[model samples]
Target: MAMIVFYEKPGCMNNTRQKQLLAQSGHDVVALDIRAQGWSPETLRPFFHGVPVAEWFNRAAPRIKSGAVVPEAMAAAEALAEMCLDPLLIRRPLMESGGRRMAGFDEEAVNAWIGLTPVSEPISETCPRSDGMCSVPGRGN
Candidate 1:
């Protein structure tokens, strides 16, 4: 019922699934390539409203997984600056609708914000692969 602005990394499995769920719920999904977008701290900061700085990151990112970038250790300004430098550091499926913005797809949270169709199986936030890395083309630091 809502027009969702879904920012995602193109070809990411989780993002694809998230979009499908929104569509099935009858929401209009406008999928944009997060990596390709020109983002600034001001524009990108809203998605993580009320969330801790550490949780603003895409945990599946190579830098994070490798421990090269410690989200928990960084300050809010530092985290936002790094994320703006590399969009891959930002969480997936950053969504906006009806002037409200959110990061990540917690089923209950999304459903509460804008109703999601009932699903028997749970929609997970992470990549399903054992390697823990998403198969995103051209993905790098």
Candidate 2:
């Protein structure tokens, strides 16, 4: 198993589930809050390597849902600029392992890299709360 640094938004249920799956896959996860990290375009660019700007964003983010931004219309620099202006615009689970990094969790890619397989099927149901549904920090309750 490999150790992975997983950058995520705290209080996001999906992020929690993603972490759980990673652990179940036998990965050693080190989860960190994306907001707390001091990130710049220089550091952030690698996560999106070989990935399109649109793929780097959190499609569920309110701004994106409200159609305020369209990922395809923006250039890579523009996309990075916008995300630097609001980190929340970036996708969840910026992952790093084996000196390589990527944005979001591509199941196939992860499995190939770490030899993790699906034991239980994924939860198909979406989170049944408002977009702002958040929990108290440090309390998994």
Candidate 3:
């Protein structure tokens, strides 16, 4: 079993589900509060490797949802700066195992990296809510 360092926003449903999946798959999950962990560009940048700058953001974040922060319009450095200042802007469940790290829970990618139990229902990436709002109380970062 792998030891996974999972950085997430507290009280986030998606993050809770993701951790459950990892644990059920026999991995040891160490959950951290993403908002409380002070992050810098160098440390946070690796989670988003190969992804476009726009995709690095948490679309559910209030700033993004409210049109206060435009992910698509920012450059890589600028985006990183913004996210470092407000971690809620960073995508959910930034995961690390062994020496590798990744952002977001892409089921296929995660399965390949650390093996997830096969499921008919999709369990990663997509928000479970349909109203464009999360079920958890208090707006997601």
Candidate 4:
């Protein structure tokens, strides 16, 4: 079992589920509450590596779903500035293992990267996890 540092929104249902899945997969999970940790922009930014800044958001959050926060319109500086102010805007369950960090949860990617157990995230048409839309809005912006 690989040791994983998972940062998450404490009361979020989806984050809890993700942690459960990881533990069931036989990985050693160390979960932390992102809000309580008082995140810094530099530290949080790495989790989003290679991912568009827009991908780093929680869909269920009021600020984001209300159409107030749009990632594509902002640069790295703008995005990080906004995220440091509000941890809720940041992605849930940022994961780190083996010196590599990843934002959000992609079952295939997780399995491929760190060898998660065979249990795959359930497929759904209705947004179950409330994670940001696969792509940030306004890609066609």
lDDT of 3 at 134: 48
Q: What shift in Å separates residue 103 of candidate 4 from its native position after superposition?
A: 0.6
Overall lDDT per candidate, in order of appearance? 0.89, 0.77, 0.86, 0.74
Better of 1 and 3 by lDDT: 1
How many pairs in model 3 have backbone atoms within 3 A of each other, for residues 3 or more apart or on separate chains, i.e. clashes? Answer: 0
Candidate 2, TM-score vs. the true structure? 0.84
Off by over 4 Å in 4: 120-141
Model 3 off-target regions past 4 Å?
124-141
Tens-digit lDDT string for candidate 2 (23-103): 987889999988778778898999998887778887766677788989889998888888888777888778899998978
RMSD of 2: 3.0
Model 3, poorest ten-residue lDDT window?
126-135
For each predicted model, how many residue pairs clash, with residues at least 3 apart or on different chains? 0, 0, 0, 0
Off by over 4 Å in 2: 123-141
Model 1 lDDT, full chain set: 0.89
Where does candidate 2 have its weakest 10-residue lDDT segment? 123-132
User: Model 4 residue 88 lDDT?
Assistant: 73
Give the higher-TM-score candidate: 1 or 2. 1
Model 2, residue 61: C-alpha shift (Å): 1.1
Residues 43-131 of candidate 3 have per-residue lDDT tens digits of 99999989999999988777888899999999999999999999988888899999999999989999999999877687656556654
Clashing pairs in 4: none
lDDT of 1 by residue, 1-141 (tens): 999999988777888888999999999999998988889999999999999999999888878888989998999999999999988899887999999999999999999999999988988888775555566556651
